[model samples]
Target: MNVITDNLGMLGQGLVTTLTIAFIGYACALVVGTVIAIFRVSPIPPLRALGAAWVTVACNIPTLCLMILAAFAAPRAGVPLSLFAAAVTAIVFSASGFVCETVRSGINSVSKGQIEAARALGMPFGLIIGAVVLPQALARTIQPLVNIFISCLIGSSLAAAIGVPELTNVTQQLNLRYAQAVITFLTSGLTYLAIAFLATKLGGLLERRITGREAHA
Candidate 1:
């Protein structure tokens, strides 16, 4: 209580930084993952292969390794990044693989008959995908995407290792300063748990609303 009360402002800033990293990272991951998913489903063999290779590499590498590479190696490779950018980049790179797979699964769940009908109507590949596939696929993917967002949020803690001073980093600092590791860590854990719970509940509500609308339509 003393530690928390004394450092409320610092904790608040840390929370904000954590949320910023998570949201930015997840948003970038969503865009990149969706593009890769499109590539995986593309008629062109090369695109599919490229998508496959990306998923294979990204999924196989550990997030911490990616963080190190982005934070340390990239600079040596002439691509410098701030700590925040490196953290977000690592999250985007690692999480995009799962996002791609999740979106690909959603795309596969779309009715084949509808796709066939669109093709029969002489719709171009892009048009058919944009009009007849993506909407339905994305709709089906809301819950899974929400889960990915939650994972991204939790994973942002790893940014602390790279000195981004996010929630976990601040908690560690407070623990050292106060010599109250248990209470400080517990407080941080509860904060994460609360955020995750709220996100889950909101995701469920959104899923239900979307499902109801689709049913009525």
Candidate 2:
């Protein structure tokens, strides 16, 4: 009530920061994850092993622990990062593991018969993957990737642990100042819900458009 009215600017800034971190993290994760997924599916055994190792390590470690290490230990090891960078880095690293797995699953979902047909037609590996496999695989993966994006958005709140001043952190600060924990936290919670709702709706729309195009093609 009064708490929110009095701190509209603060909440707004926090929301912006949250969105910035989440979007950047998700974008980086998508790229890195795709690369890792390729590696997992590579003809080279070493590349597959490397991708497996990455997924195992990244997925095993907790995201918060990764953030703490990035924020604290990295500086001690002579790789200094601002709080924001550390937060984004941790989010990207953690989210990429899940993204990699999701994409690999999508890759696996591609029709083996189609791959065999392409090979029978003498298509090069790169051409087959680029022209035939990836488009279909990516199309099938839209919903899972969208779910990952939403997870990344929610996970961005963990940045508050390292003083990133995102929505959760701002809510904590306001709560301390105003002593209105319920109202302050509820406001932040509702904001997160609203953003997630919008993201899901947009994702559904995009999925439908892509599906329609695929059907037509």
Candidate 3:
């Protein structure tokens, strides 16, 4: 605490970087996950297989290893990214797999009758998916998405490994300077808890709103 005071501003700057990386990663993951989930449930065999393979590869890899591989290997392979982009990209690829699986379950929970009715009404494939399937799947996916978001929030701490200067990394700097690992970690934990709470509550509220609308309609 005492030893860290002079560097608190620097630490705050690092915290912002952490949040930015996490947000970018999660946003990208959300898009990738949605695409994967859609493909996983598609009628096309190759698309489904591709989605499955991606999930297996991404999900099975360790976080730090993925970060390192993405950060370092990419340059070696010729398609290079900065440390921050690499960390964010790795997080997106990894997190998207779990989110894809969770969303597939949500898609499954959408009743078959909805699809049948949509087809019977002459709704085109795209229309059926856009109008009927997605709404229901999204409603169900909300809770799980909230859960996924919370996990991402915690996992973002790992960005430190790639020199991203995220909250955990900044926390480490503070701990090193002040020799107050316990206090620094506790503060970081509380900040994460607050983010988790907000995510859960807001997602739940949105979920309920849509569900309520569906019920009334």
Candidate 4:
């Protein structure tokens, strides 16, 4: 209690940073992932190859290594990038790979007949995908997407490595300053638990809404 009481302002700031990183990273991931997923399923061979290669390479590299490379290597090579930006980039790229795969799977689950019907209606590829396919794919994929979001939330803790003032970093600093290791760790863990619980509940609500909409559609 004293640990939190003494550092309430700092902890609040850290929480805000964590949320910022998580949300911004996820938003970036959503866009990049959706694009990659489309490319992965495109009829064009080169696009499919490019998308597959991206997913393979990004998925193979660990998020921490990506963050390190973005933060350290890119700067050394004349690209000026901040640690916070680099950390978020790492989260985006890594999480986007998983999101790409998940979205692709959802797209694949769409019935071939529906796609053929859309084509028969003289729909362009983009309209078919956007209007006839993406909605259904996303509806079917809400749970997996939410799961990925939860993973991204947990991964934001790695921002501490880049000196980002996110939750884990602040907790570690506070613990060092106060020498209350047990209390500090417990508080941090509980905070994370609360965030995770909220994410799960939110995911459930989203899933229900999407499912209902799809059913009506």
TM-score of candidate 1 relative to the true fold = 0.98
Residue 6: error of model 1 in Å? 0.6
Candidates 2 and 4, the one with greater lDDT? 2
Q: How many backbone clashes does candidate 3 have?
A: 0
Across residues 70-105, which tens digit of lDDT does each residue of candidate 4 receive?
999999999988999998999999999999999999
| Residue pairs in collision within model 1 | none
CA lDDT of every candidate: 0.92, 0.92, 0.84, 0.91
* Candidate that would win on TM-score: 1
Regions more than 4 Å wrong, model 2 = none
For residues 3-117, could you state the per-residue lDDT of candidate 1 as single tens digits? 9989999999999999999999999999999899999999999999999999999899988889889999999999999989999999998889999999999899999999999
Give the least accurate 10-residue stretch of model 2, judged by summed lDDT. Answer: 125-134
Q: Name every residue pair that clashes in candidate 4.
A: none
Q: Which of candidates 3 and 4 is the stronger one according to TM-score?
A: 4
Question: Which residues of candidate 1, in runs, are more than 4 Å off?
Answer: none
Which of candidates 1 and 2 is the stronger one according to TM-score?
1
lDDT of 3 at 89: 84
Candidate 4 stretches greater than 4 Å from native? none
**Alpha carbon deviation, residue 163, candidate 4 (Å):** 0.7
